[model samples]
Target: MSDTAATSSRRLPPANGATLGAMFVAGAVATMAFDLWGQILSPGLGWATLSPHGLARSLLGRFGLPNGDFAGYFVHFYLVGLLGYPLGWLLVFRPAWRAVIGAGGPWILPAALYGLALWVFAIGGITAIAGLPFFLDFTGITWVALIGHVLYGIVLVAVLRRFRLG
Candidate 1:
């Protein structure tokens, strides 16, 4: 068979259980790092709305949950960890998809793009559904969110690398 045929015919390996778990932990850490950054900057930046805790509070409140700051913490970490599962599983097990996305190189760019997409979905879709104004304004909160997302991407990439996950 030709090289291309052979490559195409090769099946991806199974997902590494340890890597998958590590990825989830990495995601949770990255998310918390982003939220911590937001909390640190929100006061001086005058963008308390950018706090993950605050956003989670609003989202939980919308669903009529006991939406305190503590509850928001759980919600934020849980969602972040949950989001990591698919990303980790697919990338770790599916080499073809990873190659297609150029994940073999430095992961910062793709991961940052992923973070930006998450921000768009959160502010544009989730916030809109919660009856809040969409992320139309490029204000401090916008900057905060953007920066936080980038930070999250950076941390996620770093942790994944440390864990030797694809």
Candidate 2:
């Protein structure tokens, strides 16, 4: 096979039990890190607090569903953090990144950029869906959220690397 073909074929590590477990662990830990930044650290530092539950509730309310704290937490923790974001990282972003960048360098910059993209998706898309202004009108909260998300992405990649999964 040509070098390009070989590179493409091996771009992603095989997905198996260990890999999936690592992704789950990375996702959960990263989510916890984001929650800490939003709920504790940022607030203690006089920054805006992030209420992901409220966002979840709002989205649920829009759909005329039960918008309880439990529901919100479920969406935030189980759905998005544990499943969605990790899957996006492993199955989507990593592949595209390897394809474009040839998978031979550090992942920090790409991880940060991925986090930034997620921030946009959250601020731009999720907020609008939850009936908030676009990007929260770029308020202080928006910038704080940016930092939280970047922290999340970094943590995610770091943990994955720890497992040799990245």
> Considering every candidate listed, which one attains the maximal lDDT?
2
lDDT of 2 by residue, 65-164 (tens): 9999999999988888888888888778888988788678878988998899889888889999989999999988898889988898889989998998
Query: What is the alpha-carbon lDDT of model 1 when measured against the actual structure?
Result: 0.66
> Candidate 2, residue 138: CA error in Å?
1.5
Q: If scored against the real structure, what TM-score would every candidate get?
A: 0.72, 0.91
lDDT for each residue of candidate 1 in 1-166, tens digit (9 for 90 to 100): 9987676445332356785687677787887778777877566666655566667788878888899878887767776544643364335423544657644565676667666766787777767766677883566787788778778777776776687653
How many backbone clashes does every candidate have? 0, 0
Superposed Cα RMSD, model 1: 4.5
Off by over 4 Å in 1: 1-17, 41-49, 81-100
